[model samples]
Target: MALHPALTPVADLVGTWRGPGRGEYPTITSFTYTEEVTFTDVGKPFLTYLQRTWSPAGDPMHTETGFFRVAGGEAVEFVLAQPTGQTELAEGSLVTEPRGFATELHSRVVNAASAKIVDATIRRLRLDGDELTTEFAMAAVGLPMTHHLGSVLTRTA
Candidate 1:
Protein backbone atom coordinates (compact mmCIF):
# COMPACT_ATOMS: atom_id res chain seq x y z
CA MET A 1 0.00 0.00 0.00
CA ALA A 2 1.04 3.56 -0.67
CA LEU A 3 1.74 6.05 2.08
CA HIS A 4 -0.98 8.46 3.11
CA PRO A 5 -0.60 11.93 1.59
CA ALA A 6 -0.72 13.86 4.83
CA LEU A 7 1.83 11.57 6.39
CA THR A 8 4.41 12.19 3.70
CA PRO A 9 5.75 15.27 5.44
CA VAL A 10 6.83 13.11 8.36
CA ALA A 11 7.44 9.90 6.53
CA ASP A 12 11.07 9.72 7.54
CA LEU A 13 10.01 8.77 11.01
CA VAL A 14 8.19 5.62 9.93
CA GLY A 15 10.45 3.06 11.57
CA THR A 16 12.02 2.03 14.84
CA TRP A 17 14.80 4.09 16.41
CA ARG A 18 16.94 2.90 19.30
CA GLY A 19 19.90 4.34 21.22
CA PRO A 20 21.25 5.50 24.53
CA GLY A 21 19.83 8.49 26.40
CA ARG A 22 20.65 10.57 29.45
CA GLY A 23 18.18 12.11 31.84
CA GLU A 24 18.29 14.45 34.80
CA TYR A 25 16.03 16.62 36.91
CA PRO A 26 16.44 18.82 39.93
CA THR A 27 14.29 16.57 42.08
CA ILE A 28 15.99 13.34 41.11
CA THR A 29 19.40 11.87 40.51
CA SER A 30 20.84 11.91 37.01
CA PHE A 31 20.63 8.62 35.11
CA THR A 32 21.45 6.73 31.96
CA TYR A 33 18.96 4.77 29.88
CA THR A 34 18.38 2.89 26.67
CA GLU A 35 15.61 4.40 24.57
CA GLU A 36 13.50 2.89 21.85
CA VAL A 37 11.06 4.85 19.72
CA THR A 38 8.83 3.62 16.96
CA PHE A 39 6.70 5.37 14.38
CA THR A 40 4.43 3.17 12.30
CA ASP A 41 2.49 4.08 9.18
CA VAL A 42 -1.00 2.66 9.50
CA GLY A 43 -2.37 3.72 6.08
CA LYS A 44 -4.14 6.59 7.76
CA PRO A 45 -3.55 10.32 8.16
CA PHE A 46 -1.64 9.72 11.36
CA LEU A 47 1.28 7.64 12.54
CA THR A 48 1.16 5.48 15.63
CA TYR A 49 3.97 6.31 18.03
CA LEU A 50 5.42 4.29 20.89
CA GLN A 51 8.43 4.99 23.06
CA ARG A 52 10.09 3.10 25.87
CA THR A 53 13.14 3.50 28.01
CA TRP A 54 15.13 1.11 30.16
CA SER A 55 17.75 1.50 32.84
CA PRO A 56 21.35 0.41 32.33
CA ALA A 57 20.52 -2.76 34.24
CA GLY A 58 17.66 -3.54 31.82
CA ASP A 59 14.92 -2.50 34.18
CA PRO A 60 11.99 -0.85 32.45
CA MET A 61 11.77 2.83 33.12
CA HIS A 62 9.02 4.57 31.19
CA THR A 63 6.81 4.30 28.16
CA GLU A 64 4.66 6.56 26.04
CA THR A 65 2.02 6.05 23.37
CA GLY A 66 0.97 8.72 20.93
CA PHE A 67 -0.21 9.64 17.49
CA PHE A 68 1.35 12.09 15.06
CA ARG A 69 -0.92 13.94 12.68
CA VAL A 70 -0.67 16.77 10.22
CA ALA A 71 -3.03 19.40 11.49
CA GLY A 72 -3.07 21.31 8.22
CA GLY A 73 -0.45 22.64 5.84
CA GLU A 74 2.94 22.51 7.56
CA ALA A 75 1.47 22.47 11.04
CA VAL A 76 1.45 19.18 12.95
CA GLU A 77 -0.18 17.79 16.03
CA PHE A 78 0.97 15.16 18.47
CA VAL A 79 -1.35 13.56 20.99
CA LEU A 80 0.44 11.59 23.68
CA ALA A 81 -0.37 9.73 26.85
CA GLN A 82 1.88 8.08 29.39
CA PRO A 83 1.32 5.63 32.21
CA THR A 84 2.20 8.40 34.60
CA GLY A 85 -1.26 9.91 34.12
CA GLN A 86 -0.54 12.78 31.77
CA THR A 87 -2.14 13.31 28.40
CA GLU A 88 -0.59 15.94 26.17
CA LEU A 89 -1.70 17.73 23.03
CA ALA A 90 1.23 19.32 21.29
CA GLU A 91 0.98 21.55 18.24
CA GLY A 92 3.71 23.00 16.09
CA SER A 93 5.02 23.47 12.59
CA LEU A 94 7.22 21.02 10.68
CA VAL A 95 10.14 22.51 8.83
CA THR A 96 12.45 20.91 6.34
CA GLU A 97 16.16 20.86 7.05
CA PRO A 98 19.27 19.92 5.13
CA ARG A 99 19.07 16.30 6.12
CA GLY A 100 15.48 15.85 7.31
CA PHE A 101 12.56 17.60 8.98
CA ALA A 102 12.43 18.95 12.51
CA THR A 103 9.63 20.07 14.78
CA GLU A 104 9.48 21.75 18.16
CA LEU A 105 6.20 21.19 19.88
CA HIS A 106 4.76 22.89 22.92
CA SER A 107 2.11 20.94 24.72
CA ARG A 108 -0.95 21.53 26.82
CA VAL A 109 -0.96 18.97 29.58
CA VAL A 110 -3.83 17.30 31.41
CA ASN A 111 -3.14 15.39 34.55
CA ALA A 112 -5.15 12.91 36.53
CA ALA A 113 -6.20 13.96 40.02
CA SER A 114 -3.57 11.74 41.59
CA ALA A 115 -0.86 12.46 39.05
CA LYS A 116 2.16 14.57 39.67
CA ILE A 117 1.82 18.26 38.91
CA VAL A 118 2.88 18.81 35.34
CA ASP A 119 2.07 22.26 33.99
CA ALA A 120 3.57 22.08 30.53
CA THR A 121 6.10 20.33 28.29
CA ILE A 122 8.11 20.92 25.15
CA ARG A 123 9.42 18.21 22.85
CA ARG A 124 11.92 18.74 20.06
CA LEU A 125 12.74 16.14 17.44
CA ARG A 126 15.33 16.17 14.70
CA LEU A 127 15.88 13.51 12.12
CA ASP A 128 19.14 13.50 10.20
CA GLY A 129 19.55 10.67 7.78
CA ASP A 130 19.08 7.51 9.85
CA GLU A 131 19.67 9.19 13.19
CA LEU A 132 16.93 10.64 15.36
CA THR A 133 17.70 13.00 18.20
CA THR A 134 15.19 14.06 20.80
CA GLU A 135 15.08 16.63 23.55
CA PHE A 136 12.44 16.97 26.23
CA ALA A 137 11.79 19.51 28.96
CA MET A 138 8.90 19.97 31.31
CA ALA A 139 7.44 22.08 34.07
CA ALA A 140 6.30 20.12 37.08
CA VAL A 141 6.50 19.72 40.84
CA GLY A 142 6.45 23.50 41.39
CA LEU A 143 9.63 23.93 39.39
CA PRO A 144 10.01 25.85 36.14
CA MET A 145 10.51 24.24 32.79
CA THR A 146 13.92 22.59 32.67
CA HIS A 147 15.80 20.16 30.49
CA HIS A 148 15.00 16.59 31.38
CA LEU A 149 15.97 14.04 28.77
CA GLY A 150 17.96 13.82 25.57
CA SER A 151 18.44 10.84 23.30
CA VAL A 152 20.05 9.92 20.00
CA LEU A 153 18.54 6.90 18.31
CA THR A 154 19.32 5.18 15.03
CA ARG A 155 16.84 3.71 12.59
CA THR A 156 16.77 -0.02 13.20
CA ALA A 157 14.01 -1.00 10.76
Candidate 2:
Protein backbone atom coordinates (compact mmCIF):
# COMPACT_ATOMS: atom_id res chain seq x y z
CA MET A 1 0.00 0.00 0.00
CA ALA A 2 1.15 3.51 -0.78
CA LEU A 3 1.42 5.97 2.08
CA HIS A 4 -0.34 9.26 1.67
CA PRO A 5 2.07 12.11 0.86
CA ALA A 6 0.80 13.88 3.92
CA LEU A 7 2.12 10.95 5.94
CA THR A 8 5.55 10.95 4.32
CA PRO A 9 7.11 13.03 7.05
CA VAL A 10 5.89 10.50 9.56
CA ALA A 11 6.71 7.55 7.33
CA ASP A 12 10.31 8.67 6.91
CA LEU A 13 10.68 7.74 10.59
CA VAL A 14 10.06 4.07 9.77
CA GLY A 15 13.41 2.52 10.72
CA THR A 16 15.64 1.48 13.63
CA TRP A 17 17.77 3.86 15.73
CA ARG A 18 20.06 3.39 18.72
CA GLY A 19 21.92 5.73 21.08
CA PRO A 20 22.88 6.28 24.72
CA GLY A 21 20.98 8.59 27.05
CA ARG A 22 20.72 9.59 30.71
CA GLY A 23 17.79 9.98 33.14
CA GLU A 24 17.19 11.93 36.32
CA TYR A 25 14.44 12.01 38.95
CA PRO A 26 14.24 13.60 42.39
CA THR A 27 13.66 10.17 43.90
CA ILE A 28 17.08 8.96 42.93
CA THR A 29 20.11 10.12 44.94
CA SER A 30 22.04 10.55 41.70
CA PHE A 31 21.81 9.90 37.99
CA THR A 32 21.53 6.12 37.74
CA TYR A 33 22.11 5.07 34.11
CA THR A 34 21.62 5.34 30.37
CA GLU A 35 19.21 4.06 27.74
CA GLU A 36 18.62 3.09 24.11
CA VAL A 37 15.42 3.28 22.06
CA THR A 38 14.43 1.24 19.01
CA PHE A 39 11.72 2.45 16.62
CA THR A 40 10.37 0.14 13.94
CA ASP A 41 7.80 0.84 11.27
CA VAL A 42 6.09 -2.34 10.09
CA GLY A 43 4.56 -0.71 7.04
CA LYS A 44 1.61 0.50 9.13
CA PRO A 45 0.17 3.86 10.02
CA PHE A 46 1.82 3.57 13.43
CA LEU A 47 5.39 2.99 14.56
CA THR A 48 6.33 0.09 16.82
CA TYR A 49 8.52 1.31 19.67
CA LEU A 50 10.81 -0.26 22.27
CA GLN A 51 13.09 1.31 24.85
CA ARG A 52 15.57 -0.17 27.30
CA THR A 53 17.53 1.45 30.10
CA TRP A 54 20.66 0.06 31.68
CA SER A 55 22.50 0.89 34.88
CA PRO A 56 25.92 2.53 34.66
CA ALA A 57 27.22 -0.88 35.62
CA GLY A 58 25.70 -2.31 32.45
CA ASP A 59 22.89 -4.18 34.19
CA PRO A 60 19.42 -4.00 32.66
CA MET A 61 17.10 -1.59 34.41
CA HIS A 62 13.74 -1.59 32.62
CA THR A 63 12.08 -1.83 29.21
CA GLU A 64 8.96 -0.58 27.47
CA THR A 65 7.32 -1.17 24.06
CA GLY A 66 4.25 0.20 22.31
CA PHE A 67 2.58 1.53 19.20
CA PHE A 68 2.29 5.19 18.19
CA ARG A 69 -0.39 6.37 15.79
CA VAL A 70 -1.28 9.73 14.29
CA ALA A 71 -4.81 11.08 14.21
CA GLY A 72 -6.69 14.26 13.31
CA GLY A 73 -3.72 15.66 11.30
CA GLU A 74 -1.36 16.47 14.17
CA ALA A 75 -2.63 14.44 17.10
CA VAL A 76 -0.91 11.26 18.21
CA GLU A 77 -2.05 8.44 20.46
CA PHE A 78 0.41 6.03 22.05
CA VAL A 79 -0.39 2.68 23.66
CA LEU A 80 2.51 1.06 25.48
CA ALA A 81 3.48 -1.36 28.27
CA GLN A 82 6.41 -1.56 30.68
CA PRO A 83 8.06 -4.57 32.27
CA THR A 84 7.69 -2.97 35.70
CA GLY A 85 4.06 -4.05 35.78
CA GLN A 86 2.63 -0.97 34.21
CA THR A 87 1.00 0.32 31.04
CA GLU A 88 0.55 3.77 29.50
CA LEU A 89 -1.85 5.60 27.22
CA ALA A 90 -0.96 9.05 25.98
CA GLU A 91 -2.36 11.68 23.63
CA GLY A 92 -0.65 14.64 22.00
CA SER A 93 -0.12 16.45 18.72
CA LEU A 94 2.61 16.96 16.13
CA VAL A 95 3.70 20.33 14.82
CA THR A 96 5.91 20.52 11.74
CA GLU A 97 7.13 23.84 10.54
CA PRO A 98 10.00 25.34 8.56
CA ARG A 99 12.20 25.00 11.64
CA GLY A 100 11.84 21.26 12.19
CA PHE A 101 9.59 18.33 13.11
CA ALA A 102 8.22 18.91 16.57
CA THR A 103 5.97 16.57 18.53
CA GLU A 104 4.37 17.12 21.90
CA LEU A 105 3.27 13.82 23.39
CA HIS A 106 1.64 13.40 26.79
CA SER A 107 1.52 10.02 28.47
CA ARG A 108 -0.26 8.58 31.49
CA VAL A 109 1.55 5.59 32.94
CA VAL A 110 -0.54 3.34 35.19
CA ASN A 111 0.57 1.05 38.05
CA ALA A 112 3.68 3.00 38.96
CA ALA A 113 5.54 2.63 42.25
CA SER A 114 5.63 6.06 43.92
CA ALA A 115 2.58 7.68 42.36
CA LYS A 116 -0.69 6.53 40.86
CA ILE A 117 0.45 7.50 37.36
CA VAL A 118 2.88 9.66 35.45
CA ASP A 119 1.95 12.39 33.02
CA ALA A 120 4.87 12.95 30.66
CA THR A 121 5.17 15.11 27.59
CA ILE A 122 7.87 14.36 25.04
CA ARG A 123 9.15 16.69 22.30
CA ARG A 124 11.31 15.73 19.35
CA LEU A 125 12.87 17.87 16.65
CA ARG A 126 14.58 16.83 13.47
CA LEU A 127 17.53 19.06 12.85
CA ASP A 128 19.68 19.97 9.84
CA GLY A 129 21.03 16.76 8.33
CA ASP A 130 20.40 13.49 10.19
CA GLU A 131 20.51 14.92 13.69
CA LEU A 132 17.54 14.71 16.04
CA THR A 133 17.01 16.25 19.43
CA THR A 134 14.36 15.30 21.99
CA GLU A 135 13.19 16.60 25.30
CA PHE A 136 11.00 14.84 27.84
CA ALA A 137 9.01 16.29 30.70
CA MET A 138 6.47 14.88 33.10
CA ALA A 139 4.25 15.69 36.07
CA ALA A 140 4.28 13.07 38.78
CA VAL A 141 4.06 13.13 42.54
CA GLY A 142 2.59 16.56 42.13
CA LEU A 143 5.86 17.86 40.67
CA PRO A 144 7.41 18.41 37.26
CA MET A 145 9.79 15.95 35.57
CA THR A 146 12.19 16.59 32.69
CA HIS A 147 14.94 14.84 30.71
CA HIS A 148 16.61 14.52 27.30
CA LEU A 149 17.22 11.76 24.72
CA GLY A 150 17.85 11.53 20.97
CA SER A 151 20.12 10.24 18.19
CA VAL A 152 21.20 10.51 14.55
CA LEU A 153 20.31 7.24 12.87
CA THR A 154 21.36 6.37 9.37
CA ARG A 155 19.05 4.20 7.31
CA THR A 156 20.08 0.56 7.46
CA ALA A 157 19.30 -1.91 4.74
Pick by TM-score: which candidate is best? 1
Candidate 2 per-residue lDDT over residues 54-142, each given as its tens digit: 77788987788998787766877778887655677877777766644667666777775743455554545353234344455656555
Q: Would you list the C-alpha lDDT of every candidate in the order shown? A: 0.94, 0.61
Give the range where candidate 1 is weakest over 10 consecutive residues by summed lDDT.
68-77
| Runs of candidate 2 exceeding 4 Å displacement | 1-6, 98-100, 112-129, 142-157
Candidate 2 minimal-lDDT segment of 10 residues:
148-157
Pairing residues by index, what is the TM-score of model 2? Answer: 0.72
Q: Estimate each model's TM-score.
A: 0.98, 0.72
